[model samples]
Target: KIETIDVTPLNNEQSIQASLKAFAQFNRDPYQDPGTVMRHPGLLFLSEIGEVKQQVEHINALKDELVTRMHTLNARARNTHVKMAWRGVSALQLYRHITAVDYAPRKALFSWEGRTTSISRPHSKEEFIEIILKTKDMCPAHVSPLDWDDILRKEILYIQSVQENGDLVRMKPVAPHPRLLLYKTTDVKATDTIFSNVPTFVKTAPDCTIVELTSFDFSKTTTRRKKRVFIPIVERLNMYFRPFK
Candidate 1:
């Protein structure tokens, strides 16, 4: 199973992510436990609405303090550009300003599938992966092949995608890139639905870099369809991979 979302640290939205992290934890028996999800699946800090409004003030202050506390960490990296690959829909490696994130607390209550699901986190990455595998692919009506052994053996890669408009997008920086995997999302997932619907490519072909995605949810509950629609993000994509010298 594959799922993706922008995970950034901003003091105010921690609760929202706490809710997601909770889902990440309760994902195993989400249908069974509504109470645990209410508490937290993992460690989560609590924040009041007024606290959210003051986040910007706190962040600016942290920046000033960091100027001295960690000035010796890695000065050389300031001028160096690191290269990473995006295996979902684009071969282009995004040039991002890498920096430390400031985390915030998760609010107590939120909505999921029209029902309120609380914030909690999985204790370990292994546990997180388990739920991601189960929740991202399976549905009340049908299930995709998220439990295949062959798929598990492949290296897990994270692809970030951005839709510029209706037709264009950018994908890349596939963290933990498979020694090879096409740019298509389905290819990484190795699922039959994406294989049957999306264009095909063997290994990590450049052609697979900028995939023309076709959504495959014509027959699921409205609540279910929504759950599946947002996933497997693409880092970046372009009609042309800018030639660099």
Candidate 2:
């Protein structure tokens, strides 16, 4: 069975102290990645602190390994469980794992040269919309109908596609938009969908942080061994993107 390791303790004691002391040199830059820490002089000095060089090196190496594993676990935890149908085929249950935290919003910047010069405000709708568009291009799904006329036309076309080609075409399944498209897909009885409460990003448009995570299951008998998919983070942000009640 897969298990989870409580990583909070990993950040609790002396290890965390070392990390902080090293990070202090960088003024605790919120955007610093693991590579940034390695290149920083203060962090490198931890290994040369008196006779702790060799031991510190070993600990650091282990920490790196632990961090990699933790990333995988975090990705799995953020995974979405849902049923996806392609071209009217039987819906395939999938565990969609959304990775790359760097894609998330940056922390509020509150200082500059020891003086607060700028502050983070809710990001603009255009930024979120851009992200959404890029995500849709990557996931590309059939255009969802907006009104009854559109729906009726799409339904009719869907039938014609099957009759003409003996398969679904034109009216096809598109990549999920997380916020809008997913609800319709899971509006079925076969799959149990769950959306967790987690802030993917903070939005300035509505002055509220968007907090919601979608989860899905993985199949052990699927024909595809491995697949990579991207989830549009803006779908959630759009929920709080202002102008909407």
Candidate 3:
């Protein structure tokens, strides 16, 4: 699991000190239990640490090292077919002790028909708490959102009772996975999203040729479809450009 990764192997002492220095500048006061903040439950401090101009150079250097380490890991694992698609700058996230987070299952974002579902979108901590509390009674006719939410909450609480610093968490693509973070101490970590492409296979009917099609869903309606010729594994399509160097 990514969470079990010992970042010590990937980062050097200089980079670690730089990250700690940046955190110190951002969080001047001594660590406090985020649970004490009645206004926000889990979050103590959240911001793009790169915005600190004084430490921007050091931060970027650290980020580059991390990205390079990812590529190194891929190569070491013989996953040369996989390539980094995109990555974002690291954001500093500080959580208080005893902090708990209930991440919505990835599948909840879509429906059984593979369409995006219209679920409650909470923008703030207060709003999120309200939504969770009200989910039990909201009881929409289509699905029971409460059952899964309750189960995930309990499971997270039970499984992840403690998380230390430098631990990384990876979320799988297009799967319904839940995570809970119960910080034993003031938690500080750099978070970023790295999208990667790996070799994949598409299964099709034995006798039928697979064709590619594009469609857009607007106002809950799919617009006109545009069909494209399917390129087989052995054949290369000229339509797409080569991956960037």
Candidate 4:
């Protein structure tokens, strides 16, 4: 079972302090009031922004052994290159709630090629989001979805708490799932995701602060046809370059 790490008692290393200083400098907004920034709809996210390397290193320092263990597990399972998906800091203020929903590949949940599945009928992304939202209402705020028999019969969902300072929630790499976090007290949090076997290119900006990935990838089974196999990757790369143009 995965458990949250309590970093409150741990002393910050020199490198961590330096990284935090740089991060604060880069993310500082002169126009916004410091008092109200957390209340804004667009909360500052720590990932994919300034200094990807620095951010990853910061997270590693926070939980070095756990990060190494994840890399080892991914290598054993996927036998492919491992990459940092994203890493960042989150400030969860008191009484703030975050909700997460499980994400499955659409092909897994919806019927395809007229082959009906037990999960549900074919639906678009919008419809799927609607279904998930409805499910969120089915349970009380404090109850975890794992306890809901009806939801469990069809899908898996759960709620976990990370209320204290230095509490780290670790999730294994399995399927892409969303999360909901409720902060009972003000807490500064760090989170990261590492992925393997994802076919895409990551390029940092000229300043070496921001990292962006080509959005397209092979989500389907490979075919013997050369054109079909390679065209999508070419197109995806082309798409990634469009911003430069």
Candidate 5:
């Protein structure tokens, strides 16, 4: 039988630090009965006990300093308009960063119909925003808005993405040569959705790489239908990957 505990509320860096401190204190002054210690002379070694207590005291001092620094950081982190998101192997990784709760890892939370493929590695902050703007693809209905706001405000700070067959990357401009992914099928239909609905290539192709399509039907489709859309294939589809090179 498998049991799952929801630790989303309890997970966080500060909480984990507190737990460690408590564990250290327990080890330093272990609760063994006096009678038991008397029976086993080796258990009551004064020098060893003193050393453990000294180490525990040192840890406590460090923790006190850490608390002060954390308070200062918390103060500075307030009212920040900029936000970031990370794409990793699982949402648990993202959640852990957000909440600081220690729990068993779960499957990727940002998925559709329990089916997911080809995680995105956007090339810039705008690209990341665009990815999240796709309400149908990424939004979690079960999570409360307040919880999400807190998570976004506190936990997420950098945008990490996956690209080129799971190579860990971020949405930032890099020097040398830029890398990107393209659509596998040149025959992308007008009816197809962006990113999620359409299939993308695993490898990054060249710039201005146009995919010539045969006669396509666009009649009957009125709203949100583009007569002609230029999908960037060689580089990132966002401003960062725009053909300025």
Candidate 6:
């Protein structure tokens, strides 16, 4: 890993600016992919005008390994699930993993460790297991429109969360379904085709930090063989990675 960066030095405007500045470091159209939206950090994000005030700690011990995995995606952005929280701070910390070309997902997760409080959005229970299970390789599953009942619930709760918690942190998902687009995607579900609570974090990643990891190719290959695991599919779309790892 290059090094653990303490980006806490940023506040609202600066944080927003940092996001855009970081965009300056990369050049790629994140939206060419059918579902992904071109980010407008310049317009969507606020400009920097403040100093650093709070800082959050790195909880993921394997942060370095995570960075290595990012080598595939180019400069991309995502919503994260993690938060650098304080006893009563209104603003939360967000982690935006980048892949020199695209953003990584799940690599950036949300974690809150403090009091035991919870938020909930009300909606009919969804057939979540069925819908989630339908994503099998090569095999397609059908979902009933009624099945979306709970998804809307989750989204409603997600929004309620942004209001109640006053902060958000999370990573974006790679799934192409519009229902799953929360990051830099133009297709925001029109008027609650599905409603969700405003998630605290961007589920998508702008870039990944894993490429900077020390070389361990033999180990990585072994890892793939042993676990039958592969890099995230989204990585293929990213162009920042070296032609060959």
lDDT of 6: 0.26
Best by TM-score: 2
Q: Candidate 4 vs candidate 6: which has greater lDDT?
A: 4
Q: Which ten residues in a row have the lowest lDDT in candidate 5?
A: 36-45
Candidate 6 residue-wise lDDT, 70-160, digit = tens: 4344423211211222222111111122222122232322111111212122221132222233433323247455555554445444334
| Residues 1-245 of candidate 2: C-alpha lDDT, one tens digit per residue | 11221112122265446544432242224553321222111111121233443443555476566446545644335232111212211111111111111111222211111111111234443433343444433321455434434544443343333222121111111221122101112233312122211111111222212222223112221232213222222223221212111
Candidate 4 Cα errors over 4 Å, as ranges: 1-20, 23-70, 73-147, 156-245
User: Global lDDT of each model?
Assistant: 0.27, 0.26, 0.27, 0.27, 0.28, 0.26
lDDT for 199 in candidate 2 is 11
Q: For every model shown, what is its TM-score relative to the native structure?
A: 0.17, 0.19, 0.18, 0.15, 0.17, 0.17
Total clashes, candidate 4?
Answer: 8
User: What is the Å distance of residue 205 in model 1 from its true position?
Assistant: 46
Ranking according to lDDT, highest score first:
5, 3, 4, 1, 2, 6
Off by over 4 Å in 2: 1-20, 23-39, 42-50, 74-134, 137-245
Candidate 4: clashing pairs of residues: 46-88, 51-209, 98-180, 98-181, 99-179, 99-180, 100-179, 100-180
lDDT, model 5, position 124:
51
CA shift at 28, candidate 4, in angstroms? Answer: 15
Better of 1 and 6 by TM-score: 6
Cα error, candidate 4, residue 2 (Å):
29
Which of candidates 2 and 6 is the stronger one according to TM-score? Answer: 2
